[model samples]
Target: MLSGFKLLACLLFSGQTPTENLPAQDFDEYQCSGNVEIDFPGLCALLDMKNIPAVCTKQPASLTTETEEEDTDDNKSLIDDSSIWPKPCLHAELESEDPLSAKNLKISGWRVDEQIVRVLQKMLLSLSKLQSLHFWQAGLTDQMLISLLNTISLCSNLRAVTLEGNPLPERSYHLLLSEDSILTHLSLRNNRIGNEGARLIGSALSTTRSANKNLLSLNLAFNCIGDEGAAHIAKGLRFNCALLFLSLSNNQIGDSGAGHLAATLAEFALTHEEVVERRKLLLERTQDSSLRVSSDQSSVGQLPSVPSSTSLSASKGENKAKKKEASKKEEKPAANKENPKSNKKSPDIKVPQSKGGKQGSKEKLTAQEDKPTTALNEQVEAVEIVNPLLDRLVQYRDGELILPGNTTLSSLNLEGNKITEKSLPLFLTSLEMQGEEGGLLRLCLQRNLFSPDCELYVKIKELMALRDALNKNTSEQTEEEEQGAQC
Candidate 1:
């Protein structure tokens, strides 16, 4: 009976089960052996298999010919209007969950060559929804970095990128931080960026025409930036308003670098270029105001006159009646000269004929109209003249004190650098002067040459702590208000 039962079980289970066939089916599904349209999943599989040629090859013409034949005129028009050719199959099937949507692609420990760059260019162009990209130790050269940055600049949705450990041969890293860049966070740690790179980055941050208005966080730790580089960055910070976090930790910065950075945090006189730009802006405002006033006066003067013939005739008749009454009054004035009370009333009747009252009123009106324009021009001239003298004098305080230095940076990380006790006082004085207006909430000074119990360091820490507490309270209140609004 046992032998019979075993034989029966073997007979029933002779055919392959569904689970047993799954592996073969999956392998065939993933394999891009034939001329099939590659989607996101196929792209991932090809990448895993290191099949670059398969991904870069053009799709079979047979697959698109049928669609082209079936397309209507409107569809053809739309296809012609679209900027991207051979539309990507990312969302071809309208899948609810897209692999590349809001995803981060991290390629580490790989030697990216020209073919890899081509593949990346294609992928980046297609994956418009990709948020962040990280390439760690990818062996990128200067030309490759430039190509990658140019491709990234086209992606409007990508917000953050990390290229740590990929030190380039030249200072092309600043290409990623251009004035029109959309990236909000960037990490170039361990890249060995030096003074030249920092200077380029500073120029990109704030230039003559525009500044980088999008970047919020920058990480430059584990680099070779020194005093000159720090000064360059501080010069940029004098005009930048959007950056909130800067990390210069583990660098070659010293007291001179620290002093430059500290001066940026505190109030300072505007540079020559800044003063010139201010004058230009003031002149522009004055011109705009004068134009607006002139336009208003012209509009008032151009108001429609009474066009109806009946109204014109009525006005003419009234003027004639006034002339006749004036002539009669002139004759009465001579006859009434013998009566003293009558003579006084005759002068009162003829008051409208005198030119003094009308001329005085006209002069007042013209003066009022010219007052604003003259005052504005005078102010602009005053600024242009006084600014030069103020720039020359050492003790001049009457000049405009409105152009404060950088006040938007919230955090600065200088830990593991060569900063010492001598530089600590500059930071402390800057912090104290900033008082309630400083945006710096965190300043990392650890592992520097200064002692932990340094008085200036302690005071700076205390001020930072107070600012942090206040910021926390403000954030909490904002959150509560948002919740209440939702409710």
Candidate 2:
């Protein structure tokens, strides 16, 4: 029989089960002091290896004063009580002078109670350099997930997260993919997510005002999504531009869901709502431009033309001399009598034009000459202005305007669903359309309710193969150019 400390080390390293008859005195000598760098002994002590229970229990809630309650209204209790629990298991890539250099943290096969939650929160906050976090079968609840996601949003460097085999009661997995979240990759496999959760996730992916722009890959496989959920996700795909990979395998989706997804990959006419939205955006942009131009003109006109004191005094003296000269001329009546013809005004007096008047005339002529060019430019700009939130606008045959579907998403995984042969033609047509536009390189349709030798399926695979080859060539060329530049 191994001793308690050695047994715990073996269990942690060898991935073996802990024995039931461990002595209490064996682990009593080892203790944890909340160190940032966690060792096997400290981890075993924190987990209470000597008193291992089949089920983990929640910690008793501590009583707090009214002031403390007010301070913790935003769920700060998880982060504030750092000294109450030991640190979590954090792995660092390289031991360096920097204390917060832990990069990866994986917690597996553990039931996360209140005590473990606090320690995990504290460790996440302390490890500023942590990047990826994986939790497999850690028994996370809805409340725990909410608190954990709230804490994760504050972590700047953390980008990728995986929470597998942890089913929550309320299906609140969409909270991790919020609009402001900075995570780039997320996996929520086997979480029992339903259509309602899928709807919320779609809304988070692309909302009216903003969308999740940081996330690149999302995995929602092994869930309970259906046609309605697929429709909701397709609605989101209409405007989403950042997501590159999406997996919806092993769901309950059927022909309707498959059609909804395939339609989003081809050009379709814009609905009334989208048209109104486009018009509103254009009007707002035009109003902003006009206001900016008016402000610039007003600023130019408000510029102060300051003059020197010497110039002011000289102008006053010149005005006084001119008034005296005018009076002397008025008093010379005899000279006026000698030159009576000077008193008569000329019939045709040629008025000398001022520089300002000449400049104004030239500006008017130039503006009149430029009107045609400005009108042509405005027409060109109007043709080019498309909705930035949605995909591009296209002009179809028969003088109808249409909107192109999502072209940013490169790969879509819908394997092991309930799709039938009826939906194969739809996907094939969509893929052909996408191929013409050089979009949607891959679409997974394996293990579904369709024949492998289906003609439409075969055509789709061929087209995808050709597109993949083209994309590979392009990527290789770009990589070679980058290498040459580095050299």
Candidate 3:
């Protein structure tokens, strides 16, 4: 008896493996046309089934090509324009109990259309746990690739991708480089990419943010890359340090292109060294500032509150003045009480001034006194302790100066191209451009236009010597640091 796994595997991947091959009964009910292979939604429906056995038992006759064509003709009669394309109204419903559960999808070598892309995008949107996607030689144009990318971007868990053998364009590069992409391993081998497409790929890789940071391996082999395309790629390498493996093999690269690439690498090495030093200096400064602030805080804690004594003194002075004023007021009131006739005379003398003046003066005095005390307290609290280290920490949190590490461009194959002594010199010059600690390890320049006694041979020897020296020096430095730490 066939299980659910076998049934789903059969629908998704037909005849790839013995287990994936559908049972005779199941294959007959698939409702696919003769050699057309329009089983995409049928496979999607299999993934959506709550009870595979129950759904598979009842094969709907409406899914047959005959019925579909008849439905299309019926819908076409209502419309005036005969040019309108027939829609694939097949539905892949969410019949499963768990809404979050989703299965990965892998389709290859299928003919593509606008309707197919739309249906695919809708199906991808419905899935929640799509991990990887592989589409090979699927007849994708620039617009189709864009549509696929837009749909893939919506899948949060999609990381690995293989889109080999598609005729992708420059715009496809832009879509892949978009910040929304989170692919880690992307292969575009045999894509027939041109100069503009290569430039777009390079530009996307050069992004210093999370966009291309996740990308580790990229395969651009079999793309016809000339000098112009090579230059743009070099520019991208100057800024991108996350990629560990890249292939440009089987391309139309010449000596000029090789030299351009070499120069870019050398320049990047020098710039990277300078950046590392600057970062170290800035880090040290931040650390020092942080220590200073910490010390200040500790000392502040140990020291007495300096404002307390002054505040107490001011309060005492105000209390003494208040006591004196009360005594004088008491004397005046007593004198008024003793002489009723004098009180009447005094009231007449004061009159309108006494009615409003005393109340206003008392209110003014109270407000003025409260304002000063509150202001003094606030001013003490407002003593801003500016910590430069804290500011740097904030910058780090905001993703400044926290770039991905520089990984050397590994696996360069410049096989079968017009390379001569002229290209050799430029390539050698580029190697010399590498800083003392450049990260170019392996290079393939075979089957190129090189003579036996070309000056490039001598330059290559010199570069090898420099590389050895750099490695030796680094090892020695590491040993010395270790010894010093022990001491």
RMSD of each: 21.8, 21.4, 26.2
Candidate lDDT scores, in order, read: 0.60, 0.61, 0.50
Q: Write the per-residue lDDT of candidate 2 for residues 1-487, one digit (tens) a residue.
A: 1235654554455444456333443333433222344433343444555532221111113212432442232123222323232233323332244433555566644566755665566556656676878776578898988888877988778999988667788888888888778999998776677789889888888754557788998987777889999988888777777898888877889999989999988866556576556556555555654564466456545545775677656655645654554465457432232223322321111112343565545434333322222222222344443234323433322223355677888878887789999999888887777655556777778879989998888988888887763455544433321221000
Off by over 4 Å in 1: 1-102, 284-402, 469-487
TM-score of 2: 0.61
- Model 1 TM-score? 0.58
Order of the predicted models by lDDT, top scorer first: 2, 1, 3
**Predicted candidate 1 versus true structure: per-residue lDDT over 192-280, tens digit per residue:** 88999899988887753457888998988778899999988888787677899888877889999999999989877665676556446
Candidate 3 overall lDDT versus native = 0.50
| lDDT (Cα, 0-100) at 253 in candidate 2 | 90
